[model samples]
Target: MKIKFRVILSISIIAVTTLMFVSCASDPDSSGLEYMPDMYRSPAIEPYVDYGEVRGRENKDLKLKRSAMIPPSGTIPYYGTDSATVALMMPYARKANVAMKSTHGMYDAVLTKENEYDFALADKNPLKLTSDNMGDLFDTGKKLFTANCAHCHGAKGNGNGPMVVSGAYVGVPDYANLTNLSDGQIFYSIYYGKGMMGAHNSLLDKREIWTLVHYIRKFQDTDYGTSQSAKALEAN
Candidate 1:
């Protein structure tokens, strides 16, 4: 009788100890026992979010279903009302060299038998600047630069952007050193990426890229395009 009583007592002690440990270790009001609390919650619908489960509950039918797709080739986007802007947005006449197929994955692009990137040196920036619109253009340029270039090219165009400072990427050249690059060549490099950089044509439209060219030129020549705008405003 004493042995059975001792066994029951031992079992009760173990149960009490377990309950106490659990209660002390976790807060019932909080995300109880979750090592990574974010793993248990869905804050928003992300393109890459795995919606298979939420907080230990599994039900695909309850989650938002997303389908991935790419736009078809040769489909032109609406370039808006400006005739000059529309002309500027037309397809680039220059072609990438045959080596681009293996080097830069220009498989989908029309490749050339010879090197044509060199020809881009003759190209000029079509987006002329004047004092009347220079201020607004730089304002637009600043927003575009922050959104696209600042992360990799640094806020000051010194090539020490956060990605470089954090060691996530390397070998980003300073804009000041690239003074010899023609405006058109700069456009080409961004449209069809050069070296390690990927093509940005899909991400940025042609008009936006030209605006960036004007902004980038400011790095090489601090007073670039400003005088033109100032002169135009004064003349007007």
Candidate 2:
């Protein structure tokens, strides 16, 4: 009977020891047992909210000045995941603009030496020149071009697309002709109107226009007439 009692007592002591050990363990709340390091957590959200607010404020300020925003609910596209994917996949896709169709109709005056000259192409659509393997700049240029210039320039830099031909536009210089102009010249023309072209500096920011200038220069050789004048002008 004493032996059995001693055995039972030993078992009780073991159970109490285990309970004490468990109780002494670090508290889940204090020990960060359930907490995760930032590395394990999601990436910090880009400040889209602040951006939206700032953009909204800017829009209000510029409402009376020439408005550049694409009309709400218009077919003028906002960038999408597909745009980025397509840009990555194909050079042709990267040059295409989302705003082309709308920009086609914005022209009220037509200036054409012949029915062949297309000015709407330059007037509406913006370009996206991807620099030498500068992917981030390329992506940014692509988005800006789509947002501001696609309406007239078409999806590709090729001038044969819907926007220019379908709308009330003429003298739209094709991308081929535009390429002959150097980056500085292109920026100059965009800033100060040459010929019938209006100044886009008021509408597009500098980097945005410069990026488009490169994109337009890319297709200018294959699409339209070229001039040594751009070369001569550059030399001078």
Candidate 3:
């Protein structure tokens, strides 16, 4: 009776081991049979995931559909409850020209038949420059410019940035020569892009663009935004 029991126990162990190896052999990529597959793999949907073919089952309806989508028009992202900040963060009033669809690839932007660039000339900088804020504003502007514009616009705003120096780009106008451009025009150009420059609206917020406008002004006039300049502006 003892010998027979030993033989039965050895056969049971061999059978269990063979079954484990056979399960793994079914799929080269998969390990042996999974006890709880969902524990390791999440069922939650993610953006940009192709849901057309899931678990070896193909769904024709979802084949070409993208998970990511553009936001609805006039949708304002939350900017907290600060009235002043919210106002400053509001969407720009000027619409891109229809030509911008072809010229700047702004296909989704609200397009207009009118020349909004000309309209922007009359728009004034909403960010007021005071004697107290000039220093901090310029400091922030310099940092923003360095990170975003310096590569193509130059460290000194002379259109001699590294890209121009390397002979990779041209036609970048110097800020010193653009003294005739109004603050709004400068802001618009930077926001929507001008000539070889691409639109910076995605990279910079409205306030930051306005701040850059102030900093660009300093390039044209060394004493810009200073107490003396403030007095000069007030007198004018």
Candidate 4:
């Protein structure tokens, strides 16, 4: 009985030791031989992770499908209950030019054969700058621009951003040189993108884009968005 008990204990120890070895891999990155791998790795779909060849198994259907899908058409996101804000957040009326499908990767966007960028030239910014709000608006614009535009457009809007300096990108036009661009034209370029710049519609809302329009104007004129500038704009 004693010998049998000792043998059972020895077998149990050996089994556990073997399991430890089987579970480990020489490659430090690999977690080998996972027991119930489903429990260890979730089956839930994750955006941007290629699950096409998960765990040495090929899934051709999944391989063909994009993990990150564009939002369905006509889906409006919930923006809170301010009438002005709601109006500001409403879907843009303008459509991308058909050529943008090839030039700007806007294949999924609603496209028109017409020169909509020219049409956008008539679309004035709805976020009217006032002396009371210009301070807050400019502040918000600065933050937004710093996060999204400064990398490529530069902090001073001189087209000498870190990306240009690093030789990663080129042809970022200087705001100082773009005096001919209408406010609406600048907004259109930012919304749909121009040349190498991709569409920012996905990243920024219409209000923010307009705010950026206001901020970018300051790059062209030092007095832009000032109380005096607001009065000057009203006169113009």
Candidate 5:
């Protein structure tokens, strides 16, 4: 009976071992994915497109006139101060100070010396004779010249004005003959005064002298006598 029991026990153990070995063998297709149906396949993962809160663009349905709606950026404020008062006022006072400083800082320095002219300074804006438009510049120039330069250079720029007539000065240049003189040369002489003349550099600013030069050119082409006659008739 013992031998029979041992035989039955050994058979049962062998059967259980064989079943365990079969289960451990490589599976043909027991993977969870292998049993999935075609419909169970996940749809292709589409990329995300979140556009609800994006800045700088608007997606709307509307129709309107053609116009721009861009708002302007804030502008920076601009401020300036006039510190050139000293430069402005100094030229005005410079004329009378000629006694202490023989060379007036402006054009007057040229009057103290002769033949030795500084064209660089004279050609500057105070003597811009070349920029007379519609003769207004010349008219202003003439008025200023009559007020300032006529004393010695003469009312006609002919060196024979009241000052020269009274023997107060000599050697004023004739503007009629200035056809040979460049605008720069004429401006130089006016700025620094030639011969017995003193520098107007102190008495006049650059623009004033330039305007005067512009008017001087008008006298070159104009018949002063005719104009004077016309004016005299108009006065009557």
Candidate 6:
């Protein structure tokens, strides 16, 4: 009886080893041999990563149809409550200049017959910098800037960012020299992007852009938001 049991155990071990080798030697394109096929494909949506295949099944419909598409017209995204915040985030009243249609790729956007950049100079920053929230705003602005603007604008807003210093980019202007620009014009430039820069409105929301306007003000004036006089000079 003992010899019979030992023989059966040895045969079972050999069979399992053979199965393991066969499973490991599957076809390069086949996921059918996987123990848990679901684990092979990422459950999370990853940007730019193809999800057209899973468990060796090729899904033609899952392939990306288009990398990007323009948003439909006459639609506005909800910016949430806080009337003041919503009001500040509302679409700019002025339209892009007609010349910018070709120059700035404002073809789908509402373009104005006249050059509207000069008109933007009259617009004011809606997100006011009060003494109470000034500290928090700047902190948030710094984080946003570091992530978005620092590469091109530099940490000091001096136009000598890593991109410019490395010779990969040019035409980025210094913030100190841009003191003449109104808060609204700055917002416009950032929203739509200006001179070699593309539209960042898709990347950044309105509230965040307004905060950047305040932060840019800080670059020009170190004592920004500390005095009413400074605010008076900036309100265009």
Best by TM-score: 3
User: Per-residue lDDT of 1-236 in model 4, one digit per residue for the tens?
Assistant: 99999999999999999989888889987778877778766788878878787776899888857788767889888899998888988999999999999898887888999998898877878898877888998999999999999999999999999999999999999999997788889999999999999999889989999999989998988888665675338523
| Model 6 C-alpha lDDT per residue in residues 1-236, reported as the tens digit of each score | 99999999999999999888888755677654678765876777656556676566787987764424445777666878878867877776778777777877777778778756778887777777776888999999999999999999999999989999999999999999998888878988988778898777778988899899999988988878786555535542
Per-residue lDDT for 1-236 in model 3, tens only? 99999999999999999977776746667655656656644567767877786655688998868967767878899999999889888999998888888888787889999989999988888888877787898999999999999988899999899999999999988899998888889988988887678898989999999999989988988877666675338413
**Candidate 1: which pairs clash?**
130-229, 131-229
Model 5 residue pairs with clashes: 107-201, 108-201, 110-192, 111-192, 126-206, 126-210, 141-211
Candidate 4: 10-residue stretch with minimal lDDT: 227-236
Supply candidate 6's per-residue lDDT for 146. Answer: 97
Candidate 5 global CA lDDT score: 0.53
Pick the winner on TM-score between candidates 3 and 5. Answer: 3
Local distance difference test values of all predictions, in order: 0.79, 0.47, 0.85, 0.88, 0.53, 0.81
Model 1: how far residue 172 lies from native, Å: 0.7
User: Could you give the C-alpha RMSD of every candidate to the true structure, in order shown?
Assistant: 10.3, 16.1, 4.6, 4.4, 32.5, 4.9
Model 5, backbone clash pairs (residues 3+ apart or across chains), number: 7
Clashes of each: 2, 20, 0, 0, 7, 0
The most accurate candidate by lDDT is 4
Q: Give the CA lDDT, 0 to 100, for residue 159 in model 6.
A: 93
- Model 2 scores a C-alpha lDDT of 0.47
**Residue pairs whose backbone atoms clash in candidate 4:** none
User: What is the Cα root-mean-square deviation between model 5 and the actual structure?
Assistant: 32.5
lDDT of 1 by residue, 142-234 (tens): 889999989899999999999999999899989999977888889889888888777787789887888898888777777676544442332
Span of ten consecutive residues with least summed lDDT in model 5: 88-97
Candidate 3 overall lDDT versus native: 0.85
Error of 4 at 14 (Å): 2.2
lDDT (10s digit) by residue, model 2, range 90-203: 211111122321343324222233322132233322233223434555466668767755665666755444567787555656665554445555655554445545556447
